[model samples]
Target chain A: MIRKSPMKQENRQTISGADFEEYFQPQNLEKALEIKAEYSDQIEVAAGTTDLLVANYEQLHQIKNWLDLDKIDELRKIEILENELHIGAMVTHLQLMKSDLIKEKLAVLAAAAEDVGSPQIRSRGTIGGNICTSSPAGDLLAPLLSYEASFKLQKAGAERIVRAEDFFTGPKRNLMEADELLTEIIIPLTENEREGAWVKVGRRKALVISTLTLSVVLEFEADKIIEAGIALGSVAPTPIRLWEVGELMLGSSLTELDYKQLGQEVKARINPIDDLRGTREYREDVAADVMVRALNEIERKRG
Target chain B: MQITFTVNGEERELEVTPYTRLLDLLREDLGLTGVKEGCGKGECGACTVIMNGELTASCLVPAPQADQAEILTVEGLGTRDDLHPIQESFVEAGAVQCGYCIPGMILAGKRLLDENPQPTEKEVRYGLSGNICRCTGYAKIIDAVMMAADKLAVEGSDSND
Candidate 1:
């Protein structure tokens, strides 16, 4: 006979089968936020439960009561506003890949979503979970940073917007308060003609954490780069915008030599640490190489 | 929590803890052992199931989250008397060796075929990337999926005729 451990018995008692009213699944966003504000410290907000479930299974997350947001219809809308694309936080990566608006306006984001996990993961993993997890190697972060996305966070009755660059403070840390729910992501759409490229170097072709990822967006004015945005991932504490590299590329027509210099500068700017996926030296070298490749691809596409 | 969901076409209501995973609920409470758990993590697709018309790793789904969801497991595909086209193809192509990963592989193939009736070899490999078949080396599994796709196409046309 198998004996149930004391810890398991205590856990079962805490979440007894007879008391099945612990899960709070609010159908509307307002109600969900109200619950969040009320039980800010005790309740965990779950979207697709892709990352949350995994963390809970690994015993990393101990929160038992969850405020499931999957039933909230308002948090799953993807709207193309007048000059920006407003994506609901609950929009899945698969949904992003399938959206025509995302494909046309935010091609780099769609590409990054396509390279996320396998089909199963993409089907359930949401942009909200990705942003809230705030992992250094989050595949969607680099592209969103490159696009200069901002988040719409809401609590019970108050709301605030935060730039994506400032949202992530460190690895697995963000600016979201305990009661604030990230309701939407707003990405500004450029009026001028522009090209974007995203490249991720992982250990395998699929379902692997990115060793180094790069996203580059360049706005052109008659063959010269008038504006540029560059974001790098997994080589820092959080996905970081390479402002220096973007500044260097501004007002200049990109050439092979310019890309080479920019790649080296990116390598010098980042402070990568040794990890299981790769050593600091490997990431430093390959981050530059991948940035150069992304620039080259953007250049080729521009031509 | 008391959750009600559709399993294989039948509605099921069960009382489960907040921490129970969909995989455990299916294998233990529902007694559907067809869904295997190779890795508790989502790294392996052995726990793959069709949830709400999308392929999902059941292990990564909390039981409460699947409250109103429609789930399809390997047992829902067909039986020994009437096998699914994919299952028949697996047998014909000798894709079943250890048989540990075949259920998830067949579900992955079903998802691929349901979306794209005729997928290329590369698409097949990409579709089944999450599932790891250490026994067949994936050559026979690919063959099985291709054969099933062909058979499904013919059946679809015949039904129209």
Candidate 2:
């Protein structure tokens, strides 16, 4: 017989179940909002429940009420409107990866999502939950911001659309209200002479937060740059579009540019911090490099 | 809460509180102990189960939220008398280590094989990436999943024949 180690046995230990209160599976956003407004902070809105369960285990107690957003039909939808693509908050990464609209219009967004986790995690985790966490290094935020996506947040009595740029306040923080649910992340559906991409350097391939990530969207008019958007993550307090870099790339001859100057402009934009993941200088330097690489790649494609 | 869902093909009702995780509901309330919880958090995939054809961490799923969904725990996949292809491959390839992560790995493999029977080695690896087995170094598990994929494919082909 194989001897099982102590840690393995402990990890395998069957947990004793507990008795708790009732849960409300709200079928619609209205019902979810009603429960949220009624319970206030006590009402936990869960789609995948990945973050919520870890938070609950630390306390090991019964939550009075839960607003199960999984039953909300509208939140699980994906649609393309008049030159716009609207993704419901409950849309999982797996769904996004499989969407032909996303594959064509928002390739960068889908690429960033492919790095989120394993397929199982993709099936369970939602795009909204990533935004709700609102970390400066939120993986999908950079690409979403690059597309200039707008977000529609809804509360019981009020609703608002905020640009993805202004949505986050700080690390793990957002402009969300107590009663509001992140209903949709809205983006343009144009596939002009424009292309975009999301790139990251993480510790490991899977299940690792990005050391730094870049999302670059490019639009051109006959080999001359018409529009450009450059967003950076994990190199600042919040994910942001490097407007100066975008401005530099907007009207330049992207065909065969050396990128030394464009690279310097990007380097001037970010203020990364030193942490266990990497050094500030390293992140900033690598971030500048990633931007340059993305720009050059897009420019080469132009050629 | 009165929760009714198809558990391992049997329609069963479970009276669970809002705070109870699905891992607990399966192990305690329903008395199906094949599901294990290594990490109460989602980081570890020890408590994985099939929820409406999707592989999800039972530790993260709330019990009441599982209502009306078709849930398949490890017990439902197969028995010792008639092992599923994935389960049989695990035994054959010596993939059973401490066996804590086995249930979740097997279920994940089942879900992946069910969806794509001819998945490549990389696909199989990524499919069961959620499940972590500290022992066995993943060689035999990968081999088992590959073997199972072939077995299932052959079986699927045979059934058609």
Candidate 3:
């Protein structure tokens, strides 16, 4: 049931130029899915509303309908069920930083959330929105890709899971259907000891979009690297995982691995472009440099 | 669309368009002009406020989403006659220059102190990093927050006595 607007409005105001024909806030996921299925083409799904209202405010006038998912409490939960950590799509960056569960298991993801825009942005920007926006520079993308997270996309009565690595089609583009809503992100809980780091290079310390971001998560078995996930952002059309580089590190300790060769492989895998934040050559060089430093730091910590 | 929310401890009901921003709603309708609009985008924290006990950029909040929420703008902190501890500390440290960013700075400081009663210099810097001050170079702003933490600590002990 739609909550009716209360009658008593003491301070009534109307913006002249801006208009939205309909605003729907569904209290539950079931109702939200119905609304999305009905108004699939016209409605915009709003979680934190940061990108829609701030980053892309210029396009607000063209938006005719809104499907605000704020009231759906199911999308705001962060829980661990059995061997998986289920993070609701509406979980904000601030929430991720404060979650003890996230800190213990997926600290690298939390670190990325901490590097996101200032306190205000973190408080309002949701991880699901970050994934949906599909911005290559999105702080959470590199870490999410590194963690091998999966997304739960729902429409009407059906839902499907998409791997985080395969969800993005291009910069500012994703594989989400018009009638689908990203409901939760499922990350498998690992029992192995893990060490990781999130490094972001930007113009200024705060409120600066990243020029380049690197996330490396290494699973160690008695100092031997059994599994590794290395990902880079802002160096390609989509955030990419260096599968070949990761393969080279398997079963080899940092001392046994060739740093020079691994760095060269990382540089060769990424396809960067010249933009305002950085030049293609600079990103390529820094990507290699940051990767080595991050891995070295991890090694030093393990020692 | 219509939205109902509490601003600075005062509850009010209002009619707002779907695209109407909380910044405009607070400034134009309620006359809380202390919430400045430096950068309409979320990059600059000049339009920062406390919503649902979280630091938020009012410019980025859609008015419709503010329904049934509690918001605290700079006006809610204190008046000129009786200044909030943060505002007083800013003045004592000469943290205000152009004053366009002070309201947001003051609110950010308040939010920080509310969470962390005793913040270190590094913590203060991290807390105020979101709000940029063009004139004072941020040394004094950091000092003000540190001072406020001390002042609030003393005030809390005195209240107990």
Candidate with the greatest DockQ versus the true structure: 3
RMSD of each: 4.1, 5.6, 3.2
Clashing pairs in model 1, backbone N/Cα/C closer than 3 A = none
Please provide, for model 1 over A1-303, each residue's C-alpha lDDT reduced to its tens digit, 9 standing for 90 to 100.
221212223335446455645478888988998889888878877888878877777662367568988888898999988898999999999999999989888889999999998888999899999999999999999999989999999999999999999999999999899999999999998788778999988888888999988888888887778878899899899999988888888888876247777889999999888998999999999988888888889878877
TM-scores (chain A) of the candidates = 0.92, 0.89, 0.92
What are the per-residue Cα lDDT tens digits for candidate 2 across A195-242?
776788887666667899899988767767777878988989999888
Estimate candidate 2's RMSD in Å.
5.6
Candidates, ranked, TM-score: 3, 1, 2
Among all candidates shown, the one with the greatest lDDT: 3
TM-scores, all candidates, are 0.94, 0.90, 0.95
Q: Scored by Cα lDDT, where does model 1 land?
A: 0.88
Q: Which lDDT values do the candidates have, in the order given? A: 0.88, 0.80, 0.88
| Winner on lDDT (1 vs 3) | 3
Q: A57 in model 1: Cα distance from truth in Å?
A: 1.6
Kindly list the per-residue Cα lDDT of model 3 for residues A202-274, writing each as its tens digit: 9988898899999999998887898889999999999999888999999988789877777788999999999
Better of 1 and 3 by TM-score: 3
Task: Tell me the tens digit of each residue's lDDT in model 1 across B5-95.
Answer: 8899888877777677889788877778999998887888999999999889999888878988999999999999999999999999999
